[model samples]
Structures are given as structure tokens and as C-alpha cells.
Target: MSVTVCLGSQFGDEGKGKLVDILANNANLCCRAQGGNNAGHTIVANGKTFDFHILPSGLINPKCINLVGSGCVVHVPSFFKELEALEKHGLNTTERIFISDRAHVVFDLHQLVDGLEEAELANSFIGTTRKGIGPTYSTKMTRSGVRIADIFDPEIFESKLRRLAHGFQRRFGELLKYDLEAEISRYKNYREKLVPYVIDQIPMLNSAKEQKMDILVEGANAIMLDIDYGTYPFVTSSNTGLGGVLTGLNLGWRSIKEVIGVVKAYTTRVGSGPFPSEQLNEIGDKLQGVGQEVGVTTGRKRRCGWLDLVIIKYSHDVNDYTSLNLTKLDVLDDFEEIKVATGYSFQGQKLESFPANPETLAKVDVTYETLPGWKIPTTGAKYFYDLPVNARKYVEFIEKAVGVKIRWIGVGPGRENMISR
Candidate 1:
């Protein structure tokens, strides 16, 4: 009966899918709040690995209804491509799935613009997944965008496309130095394919609420990557924070009962942005190797670091975190001593809080508290108390600092490896 929304505490790839796949059992519906193919939620179910960018993570629960809320931008090729790929793993996309007409359509031009902009930047790329997320969001906000509803009415669809093409033509000419008419003509086939998933979403999401069924409001990317709160001028296009749930669902803030923040025991970030605790040592490489920490969507190697309680506290503040699901705890098993960043010192100003400016944050020296490594493996510990003494200590230290209970701990990569508090 409750609507719980989960988002990443640090950067994305915080094992949200694994947590959602577990919580999905108690829910009847799951809704995607924002983002597109640029965001990925990887779930390992039944020995088969599936990562979805545009679809809801609750798809694993066949009985639970899946929804794509109005806040998302769907790139047709990636959406259907994901559906087709899932077929190989044996899942039917019958009545179990639904797309909101309120969602914007991410066209080929969006991807082209993303690439063109990044290509224009060359060495200074923002590490975008190039999934047309930024441009689509821009268009939607400008009210010059194409929505799922446009597809049902050819007049509106073509009209929006014409305007989008004209706008991009100017951008391409002035910015990317590429002709867009030829590119726009080439996407006719994709436009034809995207028609079915488009719809008016107010009726769609409201229908779920009327039934009193649970709808999990899912998000992509992380709160740290949010353009507003994250490192600005180097952040993603959309808001990937808890506020996205209200915008995506178009519901009152009170509708959401809980916000579950997911974080990796060790940190990993993709693309270009400021990383506070990145380590270039052999231990950092070791953690990456054991966790298989690679970008689920891009296959790019991630920047690795230690557990940063300072960033965790900042995330809790922005997302209003109700509880936390700490993932990849087992990745820290081998190190003789594990370091947790409890505080920071910037410009002779010692602080227990996170810094505001990237310049100050990047220069800040870390204040750490090293703890005994849990040499014993927690591969099958299902209860919090059952964890090795050091493992329990690590979780407790983070809980005490953040003032939030560690609601769940992920011992290993598999879904079944998770243990509830």
C-alpha cells in the first residue's frame, strides 16, 4: 500500500536493481520516475543478467505491474532493443508492462546532438552515455518536445518533429557543424516504430493509484550526478534525485512514503566528474577486480574509491533518505585495513559536512578512520548479526555517522546474497 522510491546515494551503479528486485515481491506495481537509456539498472535473476535503461526494474516480478512514468524520455530504438534482448532471456511483455503517454520521445536527433556536443568537447567529455537524455529533457522543458501522445495524433507528431528538426538544424549548424536535414530524413523508420508505446500518462499512472496497488518509483543515475545538486557544469542533464519521483509521477510529495538510498560499499563513478576518495593504489584495483565494477550500459571502466561517509551524508540530506541498502560489502573482504572517510578538511577549515564548491572539494584532504578488515567471508550471511565482527563494525560505523539504519546489506553480487537488517 506504500510507494517506495529508491535512488543512488553516490554516483549511479549503486546496485539499485538488485535491491528493487528483492523489494518488488511486496509491491504490485513499479514506475520509472525519470531518465532514459543513459541510465542503467542491472538485475541478476535466475542466473541470467538483464540490465534495463528505459524499463522498470520491477519487470523481474512477473506478477507486479510495470510502468514508465511521464518524466522519462524514451529513445525508441533502445527501448525496443531492450525488449527484444530480454526475449532471449525468456520474459513476455504482455499486459505486465505499460508506458505513459506523458513521457517524451527521444529521437535520433537527440542522440546526434549528444554525440555532436561530446565530440565537440573531445578530451573534455562529460562521460555521457550518449542516450539522448540531455537533449530530450531540454526539449521537454522548453515545451517544444514530442511526447508519447504525439504518436496517436499524426498531426501533432509530425508537427513536433518538424519543429524539433528546425531547432536542431540551427544547433547542428551553429554548434556541431553538421547538416541535420539528411539526418532527420534517415530517422523516418524509427519514428514509425515508436508509435505504439506513446500515450497520455495522467490516466495511466492515476489508474494504478486508483487500484491502491503499489507502484515503485524508480530512478536512474545518482543524486550526485544531478545537474542541480551534483558537481555543476560537469553533471548530467536531468534531476536524478528524490524530487524526480514527484515530477515523474506528477503526484503530491506526500504520496511517497519512503525513499531508499542505495550505495556501494566501495565507490565507483563513470565519465568525468569530481571523485573525492579515488585511489590509484593496488588496493583500489583489487576492489574493482573482485566486484567486476564496470559500467552496465557503456562497459567503461569505473573510477574506484573507498566508502565515503561524507558523500553518503550529503546524499541523505538531498534525497531525504529513509534507509540505506549498502551493496558490495564483500568487495572489501581482502584488505588488511579498510579506510572510511569520516570527515574532510578544506582550506584549514576542518569540517564534518560536505563542501559546496568543486574547487574546495577537490582540494580538501580526507580525514579517515581505519577499521579492522573482516578477513572472514560473508558470502551467505542473511542476518545483520550473522556478519563477521569486522563486517558488522563497518556497517555500524556508517550507520552511526549517517544517522540512518543500514536496512539491507549486499554480501555478494547475486540477488539472493542480500541480507535484511
Candidate 2:
């Protein structure tokens, strides 16, 4: 059985969707392990651009079956919206997609709480997408969140939802304004509509394993956004690393064959956090503009910087990536010099590893290794040997530093633009 897991190595937006789309062509089953609509993946194929939030990008490959695993927080309304958009694009989704019955539901109430919580935090907000992901996860952890299976039983669903809403209302007070009965009425209609998509993923995944199908797992947020291992309060609500794939999909560790970590040639983060290598000047602006560093879900301009290998190494320590995909090398074509962060020093002493505290991480000084830029576009290059000498050196430097082979090089945005190394 070949089960490959693809994850973002940096602070997300690492061009994971393109790689997943490419791999899905050979995959029998593709599954989304964690996160929710808060995560976004944009895939360009066949002269069309499709944006995925809650749905698996495997939908791009008609032959591949997609599953929204239990670890995901299902925003029922957003699910229909995404599915309908795919249908409008002439993709037949009927009987091809399924959602785990155990997946927790993200209600409009959670979204409202998300905004309220962010507003309460003010300048110190976690910079979430305000898509109810955090709130839903919080409710899930508290054991009050409603699951997809609960929806099938209206009375149970209503009772649980009301209790959850009441608890939130007590916390947020009048700031928590929502029509509980209206939401209930709305979900009454959703109950029957969602029945066909809900499933017990255990059986499905077990069958895939027994059949030795080529299964591909698409991770949402990157490792740095993982709740436990990432930058703490700034991180996402779920475990966005390898552990998530195992727990979220109900699969054993042995089921995994390859773990591909997707890393960009440069680094970019959307929300507020401690970014050691962040370039807030002309260089940052150029990367932002050329790389189109706006978030697909939040529309916020990503904070750009040099590739930080320190973070990548730390990520590798956790995910144990078998290979790497270096993306967006073309975005660096016009630069005269390119820099990569090799190490971090805090208080004039070199730090051995990534700091757990964002405050300490923010205070650390970055040590960069500069390399001569190719000054030529890599987008036209179709093979590793075809790339400019300096461009190849840049890719090689990253591969050597991370101690991982560069399996795929993304020169441009389209699927065909990727060069297999």
C-alpha cells in the first residue's frame, strides 16, 4: 500500500495544492486530515483556477475519491458553497466526495464567537481567518461541539447546540448576538441534504488499506501553525503535522510510505507572529508583489522574507519528511542576490533549535547565507539540468542544509510548470 502524506513545511502557503493535485492523478483515494475552511488551497489546471477550502483538491482528478476526515471542523454551509462552485465548473461530484460522520460541525455561532474573540484580543489577536475554525476547535475540545452524526438526530443536535450557544453567550454577553431558533430551522433543512455525504471513515480507510490503494493525505495548515509544536498562541487550533494525519484519518503510522514536505523558495506568513526573517522593506515588497503573496482565504498580504532553513530543520525533526518540494523559484528571478536564514542568535548566543516562545523567537537575530541570483527566469526550464547554474545551486543549498533530497521544483504556478528532479 502506498500512502503518501504531503504537508506544508513553512508557515503555510507553500504551494501544497499543486503538488497534491499532481499526485492525486495516481491516487485512488485522497483525504483531508485536519483544519477547516480557514485553510485554503488554490489549484490551476486545464486553464481554470479552482480554490479549495473545506474540500479536498483531489476533486480536480475525477478518478480520485475525496474524504473530509474526522479531524476537520465541518462548516456545513461553506461545504455546500464549495461543492456547488465545483459543480458550476463542470466537475461531477456526485458519489465522489464524503464527510466523516464524526467530524465536528462549525456553526455560524462559532464564527460569531471567533470575531468576538479576536475583537476582544484587539492588537494581540491570533490573526485568525475569523472562519470559526478556532472557536469550533475550542468547542470540540470542551466536549460540547456538535458532530455530523448528531445532526441526524434533531432533538440531540438541538439540545447540544443550545447548550453550547448558551455557554458562549454567558462568556461574550450581549456581544454574542445570534438567532438560535433561526439556525436550528436552517439546519433542519441541512439534515436531509447532508445525509448522503456523511460516513463512517473507519470502514472506508480500512478498505483502502486492505485493497492496497494508492492513498494520498493532504494536510491543511503547515507544521509551524500546529497548536502544540508551533509558535504557541499564534498557531492554528489543530495539529497540522504528521501526527494529525494518523489521528485525524484513523490510520496507523505504518500506513504512511512517503512524507513530502512542501517548502517555498522564500518564506511568507499571513497573520501576526514572530517572523525572524521577515523583510519589511523593498526586498519584502518585491517578493510580495512578484510571488502574489496574498492569502487565498483571508485576502491579507503575506509577510515575505528569505527562506529560513532553521524552521525547516525543526519541522523535519517533527515530521521526518522523506523529501521536499521547493516552490516559487521563479519569483526570485529578478533579484541580484538571494539570502537564506541558516541560524538564529538570541542575546548574542546561537540558539540550538527553534524557540518555543514567540517572544524569544521574535527577539532572536537571524544569521543569513547569501548567494548570487541567477538573474534569469526559471519558469521556462522543464528539467533540473536545464536550470541556470546559480538557480541549481540555490536549490542544492536548501537540499544540502535540510539533509533531504529535492524531489520536485516548482518554477511557475501551473501544474505543468513543475520540474521533476
Candidate 3:
């Protein structure tokens, strides 16, 4: 009968799906706060792996309800594609899923523009997923965007699309060509197909709160990729933390009871950003190979590095996580030693905390604390005491540094491969 907000403490792909999948069992409703199809969650259930982009993985829980809130930007075609894909897998989503009508929709033009924008900055590309998330958010802020509700009314949808097309054509008329007439016809069908899932979720969520049902808010990207808090320009367009959950779901702060921050045993980042602790050598290769560090959205190889306590400490300060979930601990089994970044040094002077500026952050040198590796597999450990001594010590070090209890540990990819304390 409580609400829990689960988010990533690092630069996303922190194994949040597994944590949400675990928590969804007890929850009645699970809502996605911010982000779009650019973020991906891979979940393993019933010996099958499901990759979720625009949908909540909580759908794996038979009795849990799912909501795509107003803070998200929905691509109608992609949304249906996901639903169709799930339905093909025998997952019936008719009554279990709901989408906020206030959610902005992403058009094909947005995706084209996203690619064009990235192409223009080839030298310093943001490494976007090309999912049109940034452009969709831009239109949403500019008040020229189309909402899910507008799609139900053809007149309103056409007017908005025309106005939006005018701006796009004026800016990149020579660079891109789009047939608005065809798009309109196609979307009319999409609207009909999506009508059932669309609803005003704010009141529904509030009503659920009044009924004292457990609500779980699953955050998309990690705290470091938050538009305002993360490394700017390289970050995602929406807030990906506690503040986002409030704005996304239209929920009061008092509705939340706990915030769980999920972090990997080692650090990995997908795309371009200032990674202070990136290991570019044998250790990095080892972690990458063992952990299978690949981006779920883009299929790009993730940059691997040692565990950085500096980043987690900063994440802890921002989100104030009630507890933590440590993932991929089994990936470190073969290592003889493990390194954790405890501090950063800039200009030969010790830095006090994580620097805000990307340039300054890029230049800072990481100071590491070496710990003995367990050199033993910890997959499917059922309890905290089941971890090897060194593995337990590693989790303990993080707990003391971040001042949050390690409530769960992800030893493998499967839903059952975890330890609860």
C-alpha cells in the first residue's frame, strides 16, 4: 500500500528492469515517468527474453497495471509495434495498460530531424538513439506539439501537424521531404487502434493513491542523464529522477514511500559523455566481455570501467535513495582485484565532488581504491550471506560510501538470479 520509485544511479542500463520486475510482483500499478523509446529494458521471464522500449516491463507481472504517463513522448507507430510484438508473444495487454492522453506524440518527421541534427554535429554528436526524443521534447516545451488526445480529433491533429510541418519545412525544406497527406491518413488508423489505451492518467493515479494501492514508478534513464542534472548536451531531454516522477505522473511528493537506486557492480556507459573512470585497457575489456555490455536501444558497445563510488555518491546526494540494488556482481568473479573510484583530482588538486561542467569533469583524474576480488561465482545467491567474503565486502564498501542499504543484488540476467536482504 505504498509507492516506490526505482531509478538508476549511474549513466543508465543499471539493470533497472530486473529490479522493477522484482518489485512489480507486490505492486498494483507501475507507471513510466519520463523518457521515450530511446531507453530500453531487457527482461527475462519464462525462459524468454523481452526487450521493452516504450512499454513498462512490469507487464511481466500478470496482475500489475501499467501506465505511460504524461512526461513521456510516445511514437504511436512504435507504441503499437511494441504492443503487437508482445501480443505475438502471448502477452494480453488489453486491460492492463493505460497511456496518459496528455503525453506528447513523436512523428516520423521528428525522427528524420533528429538524424539531420546529429549529422550536422558529426564531430561532437550527442550519440542519440535517433528516436526523436529530444526533438519531441523541444516541441512539447515550445507548445507546438501534438498530444495523444489531439489524435482522436482529425481536425485538431491535422492543424497541429500542418503548423509543425511548416516549421520543419521552413528550417529543413531542402534537406528532407515528407508527404503530409499520407502521414495524416496513416495516423487516422493509428488513432483508432490506440484509443482504448489512452486516458487521463493523473486522476486515475490519484484515485489509486486514495485506494491505498501500491504504485511503482519505473524511471527510464539514470540520474546522470537527466536533462537538468546530468552532463548537458550529451544528456537525455527529460528529468530521469525523483523530480521527473512528480512531473511525469502528476503525483504529489507525499505519494512516494521509497526510492531505490540501481547501480552495476562496474560502470558502463553507452554513447558519448564525460566518463571519468573509463578503463581503456585489459580490465575494461575483461569487464565488457564478461558483463556483455551492449546497449539495449542502439546495440552499441558500452564503454566499460571500474566501479566509481564518486558518481554513486553524487547520485545518492541527488536522489537520496532509500536503498540500492547492486547488479552484475557475477561479472567480477574471475578478477583477482577490483578498483573503485573514491575521489577525483583536477590540476593536481583533490576535487571535493563531481564537477558539473563536462569539460572539467573530462579533465579530472580519478583516484581509485583497490579491493580484493572474490574470484568466485555469485549467480542466483538467495541471501546476503551467500555472497563470497570479498563480494560482500565490495557491496559493504558501496553501502558505507553512499549511506544506503543494499536491499537487492543482481547476480545474473534472469528474473530469479538475485539476492534479497
Candidate 1 accuracy as TM-score: 0.94
Better of 1 and 3 by lDDT: 3
Total backbone collisions for each predicted model: 2, 0, 0
TM-scores of the candidates are 0.94, 0.99, 0.98
RMSD of 3: 1.0
> Which candidate ranks first by lDDT, i.e. highest?
2
Instruction: Give per-residue CA lDDT, model 1, range 155-206, as digits (tens).
Output: 6677778788777877677565444455455456655665565556677667
Give the Å error, residue 225, model 3: 0.4
lDDT of 3 by residue, 7-34 (tens): 9999999999988998999999999989
Evaluated against the true structure, the overall lDDT of model 2 is 0.95
Cα-based lDDT at residue 87, candidate 2: 94
Best by TM-score: 2
Question: 4-116 in candidate 2: lDDT tens per residue?
Answer: 99999989999999999999999999999999998899999999999999999999999999999999999999999999999999899999899999999999999999999
Any idea what lDDT model 1 has? Answer: 0.82
- Runs of candidate 3 exceeding 4 Å displacement: none
Give candidate 1's total backbone clashes: 2
**Poorest stretch of ten by lDDT in candidate 1:** 177-186
